[model samples]
Target: MLVAGCSHFAGRRPLLGYSDKGVQHADTAIVACAEQLQYVCGITGVNQISTWEKFNGGKTPWVRVLPGRQVIRMTLSNSRQLNRQDVIIDNVQAGHVYRIDVGSSGTLLTATYTDLGKLDSYTIHMPRFPLEPKAITASF
Candidate 1:
């Protein structure tokens, strides 16, 4: 396969002498980079969070892009309210995955992920979508 042969022809020549392997790698990488951009281009701000405090009588959390409902949930004893939102701006360009969790109270939030290659489709359910609430409010 040309992909397998890429490194074998690495650094073969200058502009006057370019390897077909170099061209193939460049094209492949470009397309891959574009596809990756599409994934996040649709995700931003609170829309980045899968849960917010506006629903379920402010109890249950919301999940997106995942099947199977969460019938029950619990918070650990050590868990605490965030008090402020954790803003995360991530680029998965180098095969990295980012998890952004916005707690139901809208105060507690987290962002994390498994190894990029190891992450799965459903597990990576975080979609390129709009923010929750769509608006922020503060009582005067």
Candidate 2:
């Protein structure tokens, strides 16, 4: 497991998408999720981030991604339960900024994202705290 705060160089905010080689800032877009309701967990084309980074109170408000079509997966939680969601953003432009918004009605959790201009968005919803096989195994 990758622990949060593993290195002094790895600051509280983590950079997602792209590597240490040949990255052009002009061609990259940033996606942010400011609400504590959402915790970004995976990017479709990238490796899964450490769970500690996702759930251990580590702040992941924003992430960098190559401008294009991409899927962002995250978890939404309330006091009683947690749910997972995915937002697919298409036609993301270079140097643009986006944000994910999380909301809930009772046990139904919803996540959505829109560009800075509020022109486009994608959303997903799921029931809070659906049974997970891993949870059962872990409890044993």
**C-alpha root-mean-square deviation, candidate 1:** 21.2
lDDT of 2 by residue, 29-135 (tens): 76666434344332223224322244434433456677677776666666665776777888878666677777777677777876774223222221123322111
Query: Candidate 1: minimum summed lDDT over ten consecutive residues — where?
Result: 26-35
lDDT of 1 by residue, 1-140 (tens): 55434423321221111123333321211000011211221111122232322222222121222111111122211144423333323322222222333324344433323222322221212121242222211110
Error of 2 at 89 (Å): 0.1
Error of 2 at 83 (Å): 0.9
Report clashes for each candidate as comma-separated counts.
Answer: 3, 0
Q: What lDDT does the true structure give each of the candidates?
A: 0.23, 0.51
